[model samples]
Target: MAGVHVVANQKGGVGKTTVTVNLAAVVADTLGGTADSSPVLGVSTDPQASMLEWAERAGNELPFDFEQCHDNPKLLGKLREIKQYSHIFVDTPGSLENESILQAVLTQADDVIVPLEPEPLSFNPATRSIERVIQPAGVPWRVLLNNWDPRDGTADLEQTREYIAAKRWPAFNTVIRHYKLHTRAPADGVTVVQYAKNRVALEARQDFFRLALEVLGTGGDGPRHASAVNGVSSTNGG
Candidate 1:
């Protein structure tokens, strides 16, 4: 059966939809090759149907197969039975008001990607969601550091890492820095793999590809422990 990956977080604006769209493109770029069709399927369960809207704008240019299953988590079972793709990515709701739908998706997912913003306001809600919702469901999850800024040294990054470390949450080493291309991607109705032809876009492409590898447990060391710094695991577990 194809693996179901859910991009989730209870907090809004953490880039869950962005991660879902780009990562789907990354998977399609690799799995689909130059044949012009992808084995990856992008599913959207968000009430707003953001991924569907993006696909509509992208029209026939989207790399992977796209579908809208808004508020319908059961479609996952049927999709798995079809086994038509190398992997499936589901974009989920970011607000607590949609907790039931989010929980339903998480319960059916093979893995979860929690996009965490490196800031004060995001810490508690992300931690709570991971602990109360994800952990209890026994779903394997990794937190992707989104909107990271590495210019002024590693102080803020280190602090956020420490907080995650204290909670003992698993995370990826690839940090997604804020970029104009990422901000412009959704509005442009394209993903980095298709639209990232320039400097920042190229860098963003590499970031998501690295993230895709990590999620597949083929990025050298797999998902690292929260104490991992520069891909070197500081703790015993990974």
Candidate 2:
């Protein structure tokens, strides 16, 4: 079914808007094309309007410009008016405690995607937001490790998983690494597909496509439940 998907966090600088803007562009580019002709709704609740800015940069490709909900509370109503769209992607402000923003999005969302950096510091806000805001709404959540540099074993992936284990949060298995393509996505106004053609960028593109499928109940990559050590394969039985 068509419903809202909120990209949120209680902290800042965790690539929240980056994820939202890129995912919207990705979905629009993938499904909203002439073949599917599905309308993908973009809702920008962040006062900064970073996602909205990215949509403007994206130009004519967007089925509709990102709708700015200045009142925040009016989001529910604003969303009600957009019937043509088969999916709604929303971006909320960082470190925000506005009930209306949460209420507006959660009250109607089909699912939620929380984009978090692979650091305990990042998880602090993200985890809390999920516990306090998201769970109460009773919607599904996909915890994305965004801007993650898994190579830094001690500081990044290992510690990240350590934090996830302690909290026992179910996170997405497929991740988009901290590649330049993600940062450059908005400036170039191109989806990763239209931008770089390297292994990393291509992998990220697939991860998001699978993400879209999961959201639409079409399923994604097989469950990501792997055992590792320092972010490496240290579970050898040999």
Best by TM-score: 1
Show model 1 residue runs off by greater than 4 Å: 33-36, 77-79, 151-153, 223-238
lDDT of each: 0.78, 0.66
Pick by lDDT: which candidate is best? 1
What lDDT does model 1 reach? 0.78
Candidate 1 lDDT, tens digit per residue, 103-205? Answer: 7777667778899988878898898788778777666677888988667567777888888777777778889887778878777878878764677678878
Tens digit per residue, CA lDDT, model 2, 1-238 = 4566778776878887777766776676766444236467678787777776777777765544467774657556566456777667888877565656766777776667778787767766786788888877766665787777646654677777777777666566657677777788778765555656777778778867766655555564321222221242211010
Query: Model 2, which residues run further than 4 Å from truth?
Result: 32-38, 63-65, 78-81, 97-99, 151-155, 198-200, 221-238
174 in model 2: Cα distance from truth in Å? Answer: 1.6
Task: Pick out the ten consecutive residues of candidate 2 with the lowest summed lDDT.
Answer: 229-238
Per candidate, the number of residue pairs that clash is 0, 0
